[model samples]
Target: MAVTATLTSTERQIGIAISAGLAILGLAMAAVAKTGPMALHGGMALVLGIALVFYLGGALYDHPEPTNRRHAEYYDAPTRFGIVMTLIWAVAGMGVGVWLAALMYWPEATPAVPWTSYGRLRPVHTSGVIFGFGGNALIATSFYVLQRTSRTRLADAVSPWFVLIGFNLFCLWAATGYVMGQTQSKEYAEPEWYADLWLVLVWVTYFVVYIRTLARRAEPHIYVANWYYMAFILVVAMLHIVNNLALPVTWGAGESFTIWSGVQDAMIQWWYGHNAVAFFLTAGFLGMLYYFLPVRAQRPIWSYRLSILSFWGIVFFYMWAGSHHLHYTALPYWVQTLGMTFSVMLLVPSWASAGNAIATLNGAWDKVRDDATLRFMFVAAVFYGLSTFEGSFLAIRPINSLSHFTDWTVGHVHSGTLGWVAMIVFGAIYSLVPKLWGRDDMAWPKAVEWHFWLAIAGTLIYVVSLWNAGITQGLMWRAYDEGGALSYSFIESVEAMLPYYAARTLGGGLFLAGAFLCTVNCRATMRAAGDRVDEADRPLATQPAE
Candidate 1:
């Protein structure tokens, strides 16, 4: 549906003004930079702004104004748009991932170009999947959960669009800027100063939208899902601003130097990095799992107190655990041990949340067996427990010694992201798509089953191969032949990784295929929406006197 059709004339005008302002800003940036990555980035923004301006303006005079009844129903256009963007990024991001994996074994396939180089594209894949795919899913679902749980429509429709579209623009800038080599060299916070600044603006608007809606809620208490989503939003802003503190070389240029240097910078980077995993990847999706798993399984959470315990535990313990990544570095020994301690402690809450989710499915196994959507969530809970255990284990000084630089770390990350994060997202999408589109099931119900297996097979193959590759790399490097010297050369270690890399490539390819199928299935379902409306799916606002 065209979002413009749902907006009031005032809201449309507001959208138009914002779009025009963005267009002017983009033009100024493009004109000032004149050439280079900054200019290209500005040009892209200019196009986006102009396109939105025309999009809103064209509908301004033609569309009928929405009725007051809209307040009695949830605002979901932004959610729909966000879902579509999520799928698009899933394909784009994971596609790049698979290609990168292939390039590991077939190095000759890399295009001899700056943009296609592994260094640049690596962030593209990460940002695309993490920020692009995962971020969009979180935003979309948060809106859905927030409104339903609070028993209110969104505070204002326009701001939700602003947050969703503006956030996507930030994702676009980050991915494109990486390819153009505009970065502060910070992991997960790589976009230069301007992009960071833009995100701060977008994020604050998001925070406001969330808070404003909550303030207007009909429900007396905020839901558990909202708590996790709020934590995701607030903590990420803190992490991003702190780790990305930098001085721009010039206002108009994309170049910037970080204020932090040396070991302090390393500490700051991983502090932001691992917590990005905590809040962004874990907390937000846990919110998703909390809401959707129960709804899909037709059961209440196993323990309300346990859910509370897990939430607080994750928030407290995860902050300390990031330092574990700095183990064996110039970071102080006490700090490293402290990080290790917190990481091990983290398992209690992580498993608590995961176990709570799994236990909730008791007596609902029949539904889980028959429903692929619920199964996605079930597997996600299992993997969440496994990967979190692995994370805590890897944090130990001894285990970190073997796992630190190798693909073992890589495997651990994907197990969380692919196995835990993506699985939960797909489950939410499957459960949501039908309801959102007023359908009883996906356009092709069988496709969901196909996707589940492909995803499972892909995750196993990719993670297992990397686990083997990482162990071999670590063991070979640590091996001794009684000569008090290394037994294997680095080249030999690289050679041994060839087969594993190929397997990882295959695994990634399969996952990408499943994601593509999902995108296509959603498109079909949305097209079939027609006049089928789920009357029960609405807000609880009483009608005002006409």
Candidate 2:
């Protein structure tokens, strides 16, 4: 007879209380919701609440110890959950993105369905990828990085789970609410007041958990990665709170009015929008790069001091560059110049960080050739450099005049997102999954090569097509006949985009295909047999960082 493992009495009590509280809250929200979307989201919360009860309750009755218990030093369960969530959302988000691309060419495909319309689904794709996929990856990897770099267990068992579950709940609410036409109308901050509040709670808890863990660090000096991660958390909290300042019509109502108006509102929104790209997208992932790239390459970072300089440099400069988004607007010219200047200056730190990552792989050329995962990271660093350079150029008032409202901007964003952000994330996932599963490598290593080629080809096709499209659109719009009259109608520009849109859609399809392959490969890797515990899995006390 096998012994049944169970949670302690304290753990069981806490689990039950949280479950019960969520259940009651869900039911209350469901009852109070007068709108269809609100009610549907309430029902989802209720179902999740009930599911948690069963899951926690069952764990108290019977729990199976992990098969590879010998390496019980790190808290890897949450990271694993995060990795799975990242891949799942990657597929869903990119799937929507691909659909949106298709709709650009064939708006008649979905016709009258409000839910499937491009207008609403655009937020779904953006929020889904930015928050759902990238956000989850950040949180998950942050936890792993914090523990290993800090050389301590997570601050508390329950808090990690709470942050993960609560954060995902917020994402779910945001996605579903968007589809149901419940939004606050803020780009990247579109989730309604309720969801925003929920995120606050989760984010605060994440910060507390992180700080507490750092306090318990076994190492004397905090690693450089933690600095970037800390900045990401703190800065995001500050940005989220400030930009989302709004007054809900009522406690029961879904709508809210932002406090800032006119020029102030535009300034605030772009400030938040640009920084969302900075902290949420860039900082957290840079932390991942600082740690994973070197570790996988088996090389020390080329310059610790340079990394420190670049980190602060980025944090300071990025804050001011948001105003570049307001160029050629009614905003004051001085502020516009300020934004453009800082944006140009930002190229230094951005390239420094990228160069540092690439430089770390200097003597590891053999690994880059042999390890597809490392190659992915290497390519990500290159793209980071390339995208940052493009961003700097685009921020110049002269260039912004041409690029603004053009597909060129879209191409630049995808260059960073598809080329830099998602690539590094995929590399991290591939590096992490096998380690977490107690395996030596992925179940299908060759498939990583396949995924890489597909991603590269897709990104190139998408970016190049949009670049040409945007430049052509800009030139055509600016062109004039000898009489100085407009040379082309807006419809002409729109018609010219047809071929490019088709190519972009094809590109997105390929990227989505790569993500799907990643999912399948990860699933197989997790299921593969490799129960032997290794040094990486040993407890924190036994496995201290060198």
Candidate 3:
């Protein structure tokens, strides 16, 4: 029989208190929310509150006595839960993304539905993939990496679970609120003041858990991966608070107004936006790459000094590069110039990290060839270099003049997200799933190879088609007739994008399919683990053990 893990006395007490507090707060919110989206969210909060109460109560009653067992040397439960959440959100996010791509070409596909419209669903897709999928992966892997590197278990069990659960709750609120047309109108920071506040609580707890665990490290020196993870955590918290400084219209409502106005607001928004790409997307994943790639490749990082230089370089340069998004806008010319300069300089550190990963795999060419998982990491590093280079070029004033507000920018983002970010995440997932489940390999290792090819093909088609369409649109916008009038009408560009949009939809579908395959493979691996455990527990001779 499988073992049932009951809550400890500390966990039971904390859970009961938190559940009670949430239930009270939910009732208060519901009482105030007379109608609309706020009412819906209040109802949700109330349900969650009640559910948690019963959940904790059951645990308390069923297991009155706390077990005197100690935690393992490394805590893996939260990481396991996080990995499951990551897979789920990946499918949901990418599925929405594919639907959005389809709507671009077939606008009437879901007509007369506000919730399903592109505008609302766009944030859903972006936040779902970025925060839901990528965020979970980072949190999960960071937990796993931190413990193994530090040679210590997570410091506080309750805090880690709280952070993960609370973070997901925030993601749920953000996504469902978007569908309900509730937003503060910031790009990546769209979740209203209430959601933002919840995230702050969760994030602070996450930071505490991380630092506390690090402080108890058995290793004398903190590993390099921890530095990157620290940067990701600290910088993201900083960016989130500054950019999301807003005043809610009322305690019962979802509307809010940002504190910064005009150019200042735009600057802050992109500052938050671009760095969301930096710290949230890039830095955390780099931590994964540094640790997992080296271990998988069975080699040390090529240059510790280079990695240190790149870490600081990325930290300094990325903060200023957000201004590049305001290049031709009302922002000051000097600010734009500074953004461009920092962006160009950023290529150095970006490439350094990418090169470091590739160099680490120099002597592990056989491993890369043999293991599809390692190949995913190799491809991810290449895409990281390529995307960073593309980002630098796009940041230049002249280039931004052409690529700004175009599908080229979209392609550029996917190049990083689908190519670099998602690929590394896949590699890490494949690397982790078997080990976490106590299996020697994936239940179906060949499926990983299929997923890899599908991913590559989908990414290439999506990016290349958009690149062509963007260039075509940009050139046509600038073309002049013999009379010096605009040659191509705006509709012409719209018509031009139809084929590419169809192509993009197909590509997105393929990627989503690959994600589904991963889900199947992972689930099978878990089942296999359970089967193994059952067999191990079975009696061979129908006799009791002495």
Candidate 4:
């Protein structure tokens, strides 16, 4: 359905005006940049804005004005659109990731072009998956959770679109800019000054929409899911603005330099990087798990106090844990110790959240056994527990010595991302897709079962291969002969990785296939649109107001 079909004439006009303003902004940027990635990006934005303006404008006169009853129903068109974008990014991002994984052992496959080089495409895979795929899931689910928990509709029709569409534009800019060699060279925060500024606008609007909706909520007590979602938004904004504190060489150019230097720069980067893991990857999805897992199992959260405890624990402990990444470096020893200590402390809350999720399924084992959707969630909780424990262990100074700079670190990250984050997302997508489209179940229920197994096998293969590869690299690098000389050449370690690299590539391919299957399943489900709309699916508010 067209977004404008649900909007009142006033809302449609607002959308058109916003679209026009965006077109003007893009045109201005294109005119100023004239040539280069910035110009091309501006042109893309111009096309997008023009298309939206035409879409909204075309519907403005053609569609009947929406009634006050819209205020009674939950705003869902934006959620539907966000889900579509989420799948698109899942394919694009994971496809690039599988390609990068293959390129590791098959270096000859990399194209001679600058953009296809490992350096450029690496961030494309990272940002594309993290921001594009993961971020969209968070936003879409947050909108859905916010309305249901609050018992109110979104504050306005327009802001949700602005947030989702604007955020996707930022993702597009990040990926395309990386391909065009426009980056600040910061990990995770790669997009340069203009994109950073654009995100600030988008993020603030998201926060405002969230707050406004809560203000109109009929529920007296805020849900725990919102707590995590709120943390995700607020902390990410703080992290983004701080880590991306850079001065651009020129207003129109997509080049810039960060403000921090030396050890301070390293400290700042990881502070943002690790916390991006904590808040962006962990917290937002905990919110997802909190909502979707229990709902799928038909259970209340096992422990409310435990939920609050874990939230505060994560919030307090994670901030100090980033320095562990800098252990044995030029960073102060005490700082590294502090980070390690906090990381260890983090396990209590991390496990609390994970355990809380699992415990919620106290009587739902049968459901988990029979339903692929619930199984996706149950497995996610297990991985979440295991990965967080491994993280704490790896943060220890002695352990970091062995694991640091190894593929073990890579394995750990994917364990959390693929095993925990992606699992929960797929679970949520499975659970949400059928409901959102008024379906009793997925169009291909068996496809979901296939996806679950593929994902599990893929994660195990990818993570376990990397684990062996990292340990081998670490052991070989530190090995000594009887003469106290290095026993193995670095090339030998590189050669040893060939088999593991191939294994991981295959693993990643399997995961990608499952994700692709999921996308297809969702497409089919949406198209089917089974006739089973829940009459109760709406705002509880009786009067019409934003």
What local lDDT does model 1 show for residue 204?
Answer: 93
Q: Candidate 2 — number of clashing residue pairs? A: 1
Weakest ten-residue segment in model 3 by summed lDDT: 537-546
lDDT of 4 by residue, 1-546 (tens): 566788888989999999999898889889988898888888888999999998988888878888877888898888899999999999999999999999999999998999999999999999999999999999999999999999999988899999999999999999999998988988999998888999999999999999989888999999999999999999999999999999888877788889999999999999999999999999999999999998889999999899999999999999999999999999999999999999999999999999999999998899999999999999999999999999999999999999999999999999999999999999999988999898889999999999999999999999999999999999999999999999999999999999999999999999999999999999999999976879978788645655
Worst ten in a row by lDDT for model 1 = 537-546
Off by over 4 Å in 1: 542-546
Which pairs of residues clash in candidate 3, taking residues 3 or more apart in a chain or in different chains?
none
Per-candidate TM vs. native?
0.98, 0.96, 0.95, 0.99
Instruction: Flag clash pairs in model 4.
Output: none
**Best candidate according to lDDT:** 4
Candidate structures ordered by lDDT, highest first: 4, 1, 2, 3
Question: Candidate 1's residue-wise lDDT over 80-189, tens digit each?
Answer: 99999999999999999999999999999999998999999999999999999999999999999999988888888788888988899899999988898777888888
Clashing pairs for model 2 are 73-539
Better of 1 and 4 by lDDT: 4
Superposing all C-alpha atoms, what RMSD in Å does each candidate have to the true structure? 1.5, 2.8, 5.0, 1.0
Report the error of model 3 at residue 157, Å: 0.5
